[model samples]
Target: TDKPAHARTSNLNEELGQVDTILSDKTGTLTCNSMEFIKCSVGGTAYGRGITEVERALARRKESTLPQKLGADYARLSGEKTFVKGFNFKDERIMDGNWVNEPRANVIQKFLQLLAICHTALPEIDEETGNISYEAESPDEAAFVIAAREFGFEFYERTQTSISLREFDPTSAKKVERSYQLLDVLEFNSTRKRMSVIVRDAKGKLLLLCKGADRLVNLNIMSAHAYNSDLFSLLPRHFISCPFSLEMKSAAIKAFKTSVAQQITDAKALLTSSSETPETLALIIDGKSLTYALEDDVKDLFLELAIGCASVICCRSSPKQKAQVTQMVKVKTGSTTLAVGDGANDVGMIQEADIGIGISGVEGMQAVMSSDIAIAQFRYLERLLLVHGHWCYRRISSMICYFFYKNIVFGFTLFFFEMYASFSGQAVYNDWFLSLYNVFFTSLPVIALGVFDQDVSSRYCLKFSLLYQEGVQNVLFSWVRIFGWVFNGLLSSVIIFFFCVGAMDHQAFRNSGEVVGLEILGATMYTCVVWVVNCQMALSISYFTYIQHLFIWGSIVLWYLFLMAYGAINPTISTTAFQVFIEACAPAPSFWMLTLLALGTSLLPYFVFASIQMRFFPMYHQMIQWIKADGQSNDPEYCQVVRQRSLRHTTVGYTARFEASKHFEEFSEIKSH
Candidate 1:
């Protein structure tokens, strides 16, 4: 009976929430996984917000209270708030910096056609279903074509006779009749990283424009023109170094190579038209690099500012960089973490997380099956902390404190009586009665507390308070409360013991027995024994709000009622160990008031613990105190804000997720065997 009750709790995730550090992935985790080509910069004039732009515009409708959303390329686009100084996007007309070009209005039609007709994957449309399935190897390539259709531009069909051909000129030209010419085509290869085509007009005039890896494209044009390689210089570093890849990393590499092989063909004597022998030009296209150049230019400020910009590190990155970015967050922050992802690339980072939550209804099947806690709504993220995360910590700590208080009352009397029986020939209560009370009352309430656990998110969210760690301090004092209870019970029991002994004249009932006392005094000792056994049963309800609040209170009550109605208040149990029977009536009325005062004194520990918490942990205590506050009060709005803000950070840590995921992985490891 002196042993403490066992604790039942959610895995210790709440502790992790107290940690100050948190790491997160960038791709899909920070940046949306869906990438779109909304803007392309030429000269200094920039275009498009990209797909992220469209999303921000849409999200603004929901969060209109916040500052206006800004574009990522705003540094180069906005002329007024520009940070580029002399380096503007559109300053000296089309070739100058400091302006934004409306690509959506002008050559967008041609741009769509180029992305679609020149691309490999054909959009699958169901005639009977009227459903169009646009399957592409790469999401970026697929996104471009979708935007094209969304804008009412279709990839147009072209015929050989419709347009005349022209050769490469120094400047780029839009898609037009003169755009197609019997010009040389530089094949696109994955290894080469670019694609190009040249054309010559009737007058033998040449023009060229190429799109591919910025470095390779610039190199080839400069090689042909014998122009300064400055434009081709550092092209990869500045324009293409941003990591990417959502899925199909290796397939993308293969697709890059296959597309190039399709373009190679021989040329005839006139060297014009697809009908002419394409053998010479096609032969060595796979490994060809028409021109090459290298340069080093670093963005000194960008690297420093990148600390705040949420840039991702993508070591061994795929076409998508989400996992690599997640890895970077772990190394940098060094804290237990939770990652929510729904993609194959997320698998590496998901497994790496302290809590990995894979969304079932979004993206891929692999991620859903990999997560620890799969919920329908990501917004539950807030509630999860409120209930199962940090709030769980608060509750567990409170319960432990409550148990300590109960321990005090238990220890003083249980030990005192046990010691008395062993040393002084005084066994007050029958051991059988003591065992019955322990079984019925002591454990039921604690077990019920564990079984009926519920979510508490709606109840609390607290900001960091001056008394943030009051829960821990309260736990230490709670033990003191329990001791106070035990001391009071011991004091009460001792009074009864001595009073019965002094008043009685001993009369031995058996040759081996020395009784509690002789005659009526012995009768008083018997009454005291019955009262103390029942007191222990009643006191178990201390932590509960009311008797009914305890899950097993009814069961404890039934046991007590059974004892009062049928059990004889005697030490001997030959035939009446549990059979309720009335003892002979008392010689005098019981001193009920004395027992009440003594029991109440034992509850002094509860008053002390509450007072300390009320004084020191005023924020939380005040919250409990204001449980009666109504909305009609003058401070309704202010109180609501205070309450809501309090819960924002008070989450039970993701400890359950960490442990569950760990065990799951270990289980899977064994199963894989």
Candidate 2:
């Protein structure tokens, strides 16, 4: 509640702490989803060196020769440059219309034209500024349109059936108007990895322009060796319903497979020549291939290949496939799963996982509504899980155990008092006092502990991510630990009863032969129970702030005040009982001795056990494990390996893997945008 992150359900917070695997969406969730025209491939040549926006700004500053607060380096080239909207490059050969004179000028022009007319992005002009902007279904399409505009092929207008573009015609050395009559559009879907448009140009030539994720096309080649010409023939039969000629489609498929194979061969050669491990590369697959890989015949082989690969990119994947992958991981590894996304397409995956985090972004609210936790951005997940998640699990687990312990001690003490009265069912304490003990006397301190008590700071949580393993391994709320707490409660109850009975002048009270003697005994038992429960505040691992201290210690002060008032004013307590309570509670040698002895009896043994366990046998996670080990595994050398392996299977492992992927930078960019 004190932090920016909000949890709709308290129980879900514990699940976040236990997340071992995070299945995240690529766009909007991992990458900035807001596409920047960073690099491009045209005429088999890559252009626009992959540099970020900050690097471009630095490059611009370095090239400037103005006299300023910071001096420019003369070693860097200085020039008057014509800046493109999305393209930022310092190479003179590719800048300021210089690419128009290159040998592949026609190919560049055709590439820009293809980018302009290939999708369903609609252009809008600002009435006031007269500036044109595009509305696109996806960031990739929007980036293409923006790139086309920057390359001198401005998509100015579109109707139901035609697209108009104003272009700089290098052959004519002037700007020219061109219209493409759109014959048909093949829009992208999960099944169709690419989108294409059939448009008739001004010259009456109809051409198909297409773009898609290259990973989807290139990855299938790795498995081509598993089948022969018969399988290739079957692929064409599967696409028989398509309008294209069978021969044309078959030739295109064959060419594409051949090109992909060559690409893999070249890549492997480059890696080998440089003495790099090819295993570090990711395995890429599309939805179609993923489905095939999951078939019983190839499932084992697919799992081996997927797991051994350093990374995987499942391109053009459907929502159902995403959910299937999430389920597969959970069943196989027996690990907690977390899925995060920002769109309706992710709803299935989000609902399928143990913990789902939704980012409220450009996508609709469907994912957010379905998720366990809704966040404003993906990056906030790191803090929400590590800090708040850890605290919530620790607090609730401790609160539950303490709740049980407190009630058990109070109940057992009454049972012990019942023996003194010949197994009578009568309660030792007053009905009102017994009713208020849990609700009024003890509630606030535990509530405060649950809400505000934090064993570690937020900074430490982020630094030592392995601490999150506590929840995953069920270290706090296990059966063994719960029973250990129950044992402590029973021990405390026995100590309180025997100590109070031995210290009291029972014979003197019995000589009076009044019901007031029974009342006096009840008061002594009540005070002992209160003292023992309150002592838990001192033993808790959580750091107590000033308010927490006031909540705990102030409750003890209030209890004493209530006892004094109850003895004096309550009709149930006679004059003799009042005098006995006052004598026992007052500042005197016997009172002090009795009070100190009761407190020490109830608290000392438990405190000693806790200190020994934490200081010397910390690796013994549970009392049961320690007992079973017979003191043989107390040393770090005996248990460190198993503990480290357990730690690596938890949230710490996920965080380490995430950092290695460099996905954090993408999350930062999306948040900044």
Candidate 3:
């Protein structure tokens, strides 16, 4: 909660509510913006305390054949109280020099040594506590270094030409300090997809250590196909339980020297040769492949396949590619898209989206500066979209509809009166009342409703995330709903005018013992209009706060007070309204009866319609409210029950897309939901 949601536009809530798709950056946008060394594989053997999704699937597959469990059966060492902050590995075979007993101990030592010295991270030592903390350009580098330190290969110092490390020597079974003469440090980039360091050990042994995307790392040592197959086997078996039937394809271009035109042709061929059901294809391609995939000739086909899949992973993409993907989804799907990011690279995509959510993270403020909405973390996006967004859309829509209804109710009364008066242009309300109708009498209450109205509690909104579909469907502000309100307003105008004129036509004022004249008739009709419209506002409000009550009731009181004050003025200035309320309208029995009659008659139809709708054919929001009032919303299975009862109206292909950011130094994936 340290970071609150910040909005740039007043209508951002409405936009957020209608968002059918979201395109987000991975690193600081989806993750906790931090990294931990969770699992690792070496020499075809997995070493980690955690039972990962991959291991769980393997365990299930080998359950019948194997006598013991697959993952948890592997012994894990207990963590000490003073454990490394970023290191989480706990496999007994790899902790506390135990790797010396393994057959591949020499290879494991090389791997651990490589992890310790391979990054652009600088260690920050606290002066008082003397604890080492790494300040790195990326989370992955810091994670690797910390994991290496926890594995008994501590990189203690670094100089311009050499690096020092305190490592475990299996020969003497002791920690030995050593330094390696540095040769060169090759930094990583989007194109190379890898970073490597060369060094000369004490025995004049020159060695190279590199880490990067699978394609690049495997290219130097083994055939890409064999390396990829082995690496793929170590991945989590996510496709086994996928909801959609996806034909996963990996188009990591084998050569980079191909011309743009040829690359475009290749990409088009890949798209065309895809499963006939391109809708079920999940593409895993590198940046170079994406270059041709996004070319004008192939973009359409690429979008067709990408938009349909649950995920399209574009590994090692640049900022331009991210923006291109966002624009493609927006233009092709014609759906509202929200882009989220936390770095400079994401600025383009964030600005290109319908709504941009920038995360204030370790990366920087460029994304936040360009965003329409700024938030601290990705988790808050749920409340921002589902709760606040729904509330704003509901409020604005109702306020607009009410505006139409009240204006019609007030304006059309004069139209009806003109017909009765034979087109004489006789005014139905006082001049002051007409002048102040929108400014005072009907303004504040609607403002209150517009700013504060909420149909359901925020908790209920979050609990039933599906309720947000109402806004996406434009249920509240639909053309049909608008016209229905207009028709209701017209109907109310008829009842107020005809009933007022008819009742007053043959009636006599009790105080004066005379038939009601034009002045009294006009004043009485004005009274009905004010009460009816204000009372309509009261009925429309669902969640009433003290401010709402003040505005609604205060509006009515202010109108009466204005009348009495204006009546007290001299007839020269007040004109028609001079003493009208005091002598002619206030004490007249027929005026009071007609005012009450018109008010009740005008509201009765609306009340009945609303009651019937709420009782028999309630909308989704109404049902949610009813459940909340009945205390059924707290049930954990409430959403399932609603689904089973056919309350949900499902719509598919409403995507929420996300990309990977720079600081992650990990794979970037584009997922659609």
Best by TM-score: 3
Alpha-carbon TM-score of each model against the true structure: 0.50, 0.75, 0.81
Worst 10 residues of 2 by lDDT: 245-254
Q: Name the weakest run of 10 consecutive residues (lDDT summed) in model 1.
A: 244-253
**lDDT (tens digit, per residue) of candidate 2 on 230-305:** 1111112212211111000000101123233333322222112223332233456666787898777887777556
**TM-score comparison, 2 vs 3, better candidate:** 3
Tens digits of per-residue lDDT, candidate 1, 1-673, equal 1122111223644442332212332233322344444445433335443223323433432344323344433544555432321122222322321122444323433343344333333466678986444565444545545544433333332344222222112234332333344345555544545555455545776645455544445543221100011111111221111111000000011112322223211101111123332211111111122111001132233222222221112222232233433444455445344566545656665666556655443245576566665544333433443334444555454345444433443444445655655757554444554455446544555454433332222342322221223332333235565565455455555655554444343533323454423223323443443444344434432234453354344654564465555454443542333332233222123333433444444344545655685565544434533442543224657655545543322112222233445688999999999
Clashing pairs in 3: 22-656, 22-657, 23-657, 24-658, 24-659, 26-659
lDDT of 3 by residue, 1-673 (tens): 2577688666576777777666656556644556667677776666776533323434444453333453335432433435555665666787788999987788788788888877767777789998777788777788888888888888778889988888989999988999999999999875677889999999999988787767568754311110101112212222221112111211221212223223332322322334543433335566777899999999998876665444445556778888888888788777777888888888988888888888888887898899998988766777787788888889889999999999999999898888888999778677887899999988999999988898989877866666777777778899999998999899999999899888888677546667777777777788888899999999999999999999988988898899899989988888778787888777877777888888899999999999998998777788888887888876768756664452433232212122212223343333321
Misplaced by over 4 Å in model 3 are 53-76, 79-82, 159-162, 169-177, 180-184, 198-208, 221-289, 306-316, 422-426, 506-518, 629-651, 654-673
* Residue 208 of model 1, lDDT score: 54
Highest lDDT: which candidate? 3
Name the lDDT value of residue 244 in candidate 3. 24
Clash count for candidate 2 is 0
Every candidate's lDDT? 0.38, 0.63, 0.71
